[model samples]
Target: MHLKIGEVSTIVVSSPEVAKEVLQTNDLNFADRPHQLGADIMCYGSTDIATSPYGGYWKQLRKICTIELLGATRVRSFQSIREEEVSKLITYISANTGSSINLSNKVAAMTSSITSRASFGVKYKDQDAFISLMRKLVTLAEGFIIMDLFPSQKWLHIISGMKPKLEKMHKQFDMIFENIIAEVEKTGGEVETESLLSVLLNIKDHQDLGFPLTMNNIKAVILDMFVAGSETTSAVIDWTMSEILKNPRVMIKAQEEVRKVFGSKGYSDETSLEDLKYLKAVIKETLRLHPPTPLLLPRECRETCDLKGYTIPVGTKVIVNAWAIGRDPEYWSEPEKFVPERFIDHPIDYKGFNMEYIPFGAGRRSCPGISFALPSIELCLAQLLYYYNWDLPSGGIMENIQMTEALGSSSRRASNLILVPISHNHV
Candidate 1:
């Protein structure tokens, strides 16, 4: 279908064939990101992985992300942090048994802590200022700044009084990054522990490959990891809980599987989690219904391209509406229902190869945090179900579960998910 929003004519690629042509066959032509003034500033002149133009710089940064930061080995190395955070979450929920617990807030805290510790060598609990700064950054990223969509409307920043707000956020983020860099420098060439910041600092010091990694570059990378990595993982967990509560049968089935697999094993490890076929299905179903970023990041065309007989001009913003695509009746039966069983014998996955299941997006610009994010979600969900049985507070029925979404870079629960945890033994 061809649709026009303002002067731009968009070719909506809902069909798998069209989607493949746009995202894969002519992917290089659509690899660029649309120009956004606020994004340029926040991303340090669009050097960050998500906003960078399709070129050598993007390739370099993505190499760093995949090989140095979010690579399978690197993500696996953070298992201790994952275990520790999941343990804390379990402890906290157990301590609050019978009380209405805000699972969403707790899960958000868990993800924030893990991401902070892994990326910056500082956990949220250890640094109050950093935690506050992270909260501010998430808020700023979510809020609409006039300059983002309209770069030429420079006066709107002043007229709408958004300039000061943006300036304040920039200053605060700079200070936060500066403090982190300063502390890392204080270590002074010692064989310090490995962290994302430390690795970048080493690259900067060595001037690896003759490309100097500047402070702004480091800050941009850190901001990318912090904002994208933390929020999406947190939001998914919140949605998973909501969906589980909304369908008790699915919840009980998942819980039974987790417990049966890990019985008397004390704590479930990564190996144990991998065998959780049904639990994996539940997570997949949750993502299908409520992808964290409903509309994958917009792609800008670097050259004209033809998709299904429509010409998409250069510089046109291409938005792959994953939310709409996931719910399309043509692709899915009972598209609106919360049905994990749909995936039991299904071959669809979110690794971008499958056009219909691109929750993490597709092609080269797809999210690099998929490996890290999935385990974090699976482990958290597994532990929650294994340790305690949950229910809507006040003996409420499953129908009481609200599916309303809170808008931002990622869509989250409109209201925090409060559920009563009954000990599995009691159940």
Candidate 2:
């Protein structure tokens, strides 16, 4: 689908074949991200990995992410943090058992705490401040500002007063991150486990890649981790739980699988995630139905290319609707249903292959936090399902549960998911 938003030519890819062509075959041609007004103001001029233009700097940052920041070993190092946080969540739910509880808020806070400890060594005193700023950033980044569509109209930003608002938010975030950096520097090599911040600070001076990372670069990367890691993971988990609760059979089967895996030993850490195959499928199905980033970050055409014989000119903004692609009836059977069994026999993985099921996207601009996120999600979901059984707060009535969506770049349930918890011991 091709349309014109002001002076910008926009292409929306809604099919798997075209997605493959754009995200894989001709990925380099559309590798660059479109510059958005909100992203420009929030991402430190697109220095972050998600918004950075395709070039040596992006390659270097991606290399640092894979090799140093979000490597397999580094993700595993945060296991204890995840376990502690999951325990906290379980305890909170237990206290509120037999009454309506806001599962959405609890899960979001849990993920936020886990990301905070893993990234900054300790939760910041002003953690709520960070969350508030991050919510505004996501909302703005996903918004369609007039200045973004009509890049030639530079004066419109000032006239509309959006630029100043963005600048104020950016300054507040800068102060918060700068204080975080200062505190981390004060602790200098004294911590047992290395946070991502420490690792980046260690390499801030190195220029082997022909470009040194500035403080802004480090801060931008931190923002990427927080924004991508906390909210998206929590949303997916919330959606997965909602699906399970709506389908009693699925909830029973998944819980049985989780319990049988741990058997006598209860609530193990991420290491046990490998044994929960059914739960894994549940998550995959949830992501298929509800990808965290539905449209994904927009890609800018870096060079002229012919896709499906459509002469896509240079500088056209490409939008691949992963949400639509996932539900396309051509690939999925009864695509609207939450059927985890579909993945039990299928060989689809989240590594962005096959194009038919890329929740995290594919190719050069694919999300790099997958390694850091998948385990956290699986572990968190496993613990939640293992510890207790969930019921809709609607007095044992299942139909009252609503699956309505709030769509954007980051899609979540339109309303908070409230559920009543029943302990396994009581059951």
lDDT of each: 0.79, 0.86
Tell me the tens digit of each residue's lDDT in model 1 across 1-427: 6566544545555555666777888888888887765667667887788888888878888988888888888888888888888889988988999899888778878887787777776563334555566666556667656565565566777777766765676787777777766665665734223688888877778756546678788788887777666778888888898888888888889988999898868667677887899999999999999987787777888888677777778878787878877888888899999999999978888888988788888888898878878888899998898889877887888867888987666777878888899888722
So what's the TM-score on candidate 1?
A: 0.92
Candidate 1 regions exceeding 4 Å error are: 1-15, 124-145, 186-193
List, in order, the clash count of every candidate structure. 0, 0
The Cα error of candidate 1 at residue 134, in Å, is 4.9
Q: Candidate 2 clash total?
A: 0
Best by TM-score: 2
C-alpha positional error of residue 28 in candidate 2 after TM-score superposition, expressed in Å: 0.8
lDDT of 1: 0.79
